[model samples]
Target: MFVAAIVGLLVSMLFALVRAFLGPTIYDTILSVNVFGTKTVLLIAVFGFLMGRPDFLDIALVYALINFVGVVAVARLAQSLLRDKVAMLIACVCDSQWDC
Candidate 1:
C-alpha cells in the first residue's frame, strides 16, 4: 500500500511538472510548482515511515514549512510586480496629458 501511494505521488508530481512547464499564465505555473513542493513533502514523510525512521517526519515537516513560505513569498512578489506595472501604466497615461 505504501509503495502504491509513493507511485501515485510520483505520477502526480510528473503531471504537476508538466502543467508548470506548459501553463499559459504565471499564476498557473506558480500553482503547479507549489503542488510539486507539497507532493515532495508527502513523499518524504511516507518514505520515512516505510523505512522505520521517525526522524524523517521532522525533516519533512521543516521542509513543508519552508515550501509554504517560499510559495507565499513568490505570490506576494508577483502581486507587487503586477501592482507596479499598473501604476507605471497609469503614470504614463497621466504624464501624456500633462497631469504629472
Candidate 2:
C-alpha cells in the first residue's frame, strides 16, 4: 500500500512539474510549484518511514518551510514589480494632463 501511495504521489508531482512549466499565467505556475513542493514533502515523509529513518521527517519539514518562504518571496517580488509598472503607467498618463 505504501508503495502504491508513493507511486501515486510521484505521478502527481510529475503532473505538477508539467503544469509549472506550461502554465500560461504567473499565478498558475506559482501554484503548480507550490503543489510540487508539497508533494515532495509527502514523498520524503513516506520514504523515510519505508527506510526507518524518522529524521527524514525533520528534513522534510525544513524543506517545506524553505519552499513556503521561497514562494512567498517570489510572489511578493512579482507583485511589487507589477505595482511599480502600474504606478509608472499612471504617472505617465497623468503627466500628459499636468496632474503631477
Candidate 3:
C-alpha cells in the first residue's frame, strides 16, 4: 500500500512539473509549482512511514512551511510588479491629458 502511494505521488509530481513548464500564464505555473511542492511533502511523509523513521515527518513539515512562504513571496512580487505597471500606464495617460 505504501509503495503504491509513493509511486502515485511520484507520478503526480511529474505531471505537476510538466504543467509548471508548459503553463500558459504565470499564475498557472505558480499553481503547478505549488502542487509539486505539496506532493513532495506527501511523498516524504509516506516514505518516512514506510521506513519507520518518524524524524522524516519533521523534515517534511519544514519543507511544507518553506514551500508555502516561497509561494506567497512570489505571488506578492508578481502582484506588486503588475500593480506598478498599471500605475505607470495610468500616469502616462494622465500626463498626456490637458486637464487633471
Q: Per-residue lDDT of 1-100 in model 1, one digit per residue for the tens?
A: 8899999999999999999999999988999999999999999999998888979999899989999899889989999999999999999998999964
Candidate 3, residues 56-76: lDDT per residue as tens digits?
999899999999899999989
Better of 1 and 2 by lDDT: 1
**Candidate 2 — what's its lDDT?**
0.92
**What are the Cα lDDT values of the candidates?**
0.93, 0.92, 0.94
Task: Tell me the lDDT of candidate 3.
Answer: 0.94
Cα lDDT, model 1, residue 41: 92
Ranking by lDDT: 3, 1, 2
Worst 10 residues of 1 by lDDT: 91-100
| Candidate 1 wrongly placed segments (more than 4 Å) | 92-100
RMSD of each predicted structure: 2.3, 2.5, 2.4
Clashing pairs in 1: none
TM-score of each: 0.85, 0.82, 0.84
Clashing pairs in 2: none
